[model samples]
Target: MAGPLTSLKVLDFSTLLPGPYATMMLADMGAEVLRVEAPDRVDLTKVMPPFDGKISTAFSYLTRSKRTLALNLKQAEAVDKVKELVRDYDIVVEQFRPGVMDRLGIGYETLKAINPRLIYCAITGYGQTGPYRDRAGHDINYLSIAGVSSHCGRADSGPPPLGIQVADVAGGSHHAVMGILAAVIERQQTGAGQFVDISMTDAAFALNAMAGAASLAGGQEQQPESALLNGGSFYDYYQTRDQRWLSIGSLEPQFSARLCDTLGLSELKSLALSQKPEDQQRLKTALKDKVAEKTLVEWQEIFADQDACVEPVLTITEAAEHPQLKARGMVIEVDRGDGVMQRQIGNPIIFGVKT
Candidate 1:
């Protein structure tokens, strides 16, 4: 049985995280993805540590279910070959800086001329137009430019380095997938393809979500730890006796009451709903002290039966082996096409069974 995107074909020229990630999702959904890589281009993922049978572990998962082609676009013959592939591959994803693709003679307009139904998606840090269009940037630079990092960390400490690439994955890669799919849908109505410009900074700015809405419409600018959800209230992480972290999100009155009861600090329930700075500080202090009294496992056991939104922070390895994630089939084994099966993170999308 074919997957949902069985009819789609993708030609990916992007290296590293963003574009590869987008195409990976497409391949996971049954789209045939082919990578057109330069013969000498150095992709860090290919050489990164922890190799599984010569290739790096990350490259194995990112390139799962996708075929590869080495071609140097500097050669006219190679460019012609890509143009030939454009006639068959309707979707093209690239991460080159602005004008680089045009200089290579394989830009969106060039390909669209050959195939009017080509959905060309360009993923960049600052987009196709703007002052920083050609600027070099990474995940943190985009987040900082987009103001996402402004309110993420503690006020005193400033923005701490995040463990994950929020702008690359959440902004660039995710938006490219969405834009390509949307163009595919619109093509059905208009019988034409369109250029999808996905800027990591632009998408990161959009990620402000509730905070952006409030600031744009209500004239309320949120600073670090100034918002209710960003550690302004008692709904934050607490350190346990064993130095492990536990996230507490008992915002609702019911959950707050339950949390306080579970901690034997039911008297602090009134302070939970109060937005007063002093009240919030008081509640936070109480939670910190109580949480420090026991280890993470001890608190997990005590709150196992409670409905309070309290959960211990588990390491990535612990999360992989957890019963809930195991039950959800979040861990899957991908065939490496060499009789060897490689374990990789499974796609999160759940689709209805085909009748």
Candidate 2:
């Protein structure tokens, strides 16, 4: 039995999270992905920390099920090899800044000329055309420019730096996968390949839909932590007695009522949607005082059978072992050769049609 993309062939010249992640998804779906690495510039993740003596855990996890092809694209012979290889591969993914690949003689136009059916994808920070295309940027810069960091943090404090690379993975990686797959479908009908230009910042801008509706469409900027989902309502996280945190997302009237009743704060339920600063503070303070009265474990026990959407905020290790996550098989053990098994995050999508 084979996965959905078993017959697809992908030649990946991308490194790091965004491009690698896109091709990794294809590889996981059973595509034959060949990671094309420059002879002089190996992927930095190959030497990143948390290693198994010599092998990098990060690189191992990302490059799994994919073959590697080292080539010096700077040389004419190497560029010719790539042009030849593109004729056989169905897809090509690259993550260089604008013009880098074009200078290498293996740009989209050159490859498409060789292989008309090749789906070429280019992932960059700003994109290939704009004024900032040549500018250097990472996830933080992309998020900041994309307007995602504007309403990210607390109202009192400035935007707290994100723990994850939202722009890299959510914006670039996910969108690259989407654009490539859409191109794949289109190619089936037209029998022609196309270029997929992915900009991290551009992709991240779409994630501002909720806040964008209020700001862009309504002509009023949403203040940080002043919106329903941004911590304006009574739905937020509170500190427990043991210093652990508990998240409460009882947004609906029924759920709010349940939470209020469970906490013996029935009088405050009516103020759930209050926009008044004082009322919001009073309700938040009351809930905080109540939550701080018990440990996270105690709160978890109290809400175990409740529909209040109240749950303890567990650490990464705790989350990995959590009952719900374990039951759903979100964490899986992958054998990394020589009987060495490492726990990796499982794929979320469950296809109905098994190969």
Judging by TM-score against the true structure, name the best candidate.
1
Best by lDDT: 1
Off by over 4 Å in 2: 337-339, 353-355
> What local distance difference test score does each model get?
0.92, 0.89
* lDDT computed for candidate 1: 0.92
- Candidate 1 local Cα displacement, residue 106, angstroms: 0.7
lDDT of 2 by residue, 1-355 (tens): 1578898899999998899988988888888999989889868888888887577877877887789989999999999899889889999999999889999999999999999999999999999898999999999999999888888789789787888899999999999989999999999999999999999999999889878888988887887878888787677899999999999999788998999999999999888766786787789899999999999999999999999889888888899999888877788777655478878777666678433
Q: What is the TM-score (0 to 1) of candidate 2?
A: 0.96
Model 1: lDDT of residue 191: 88
Candidate RMSDs in Å, in order, are: 1.6, 1.8
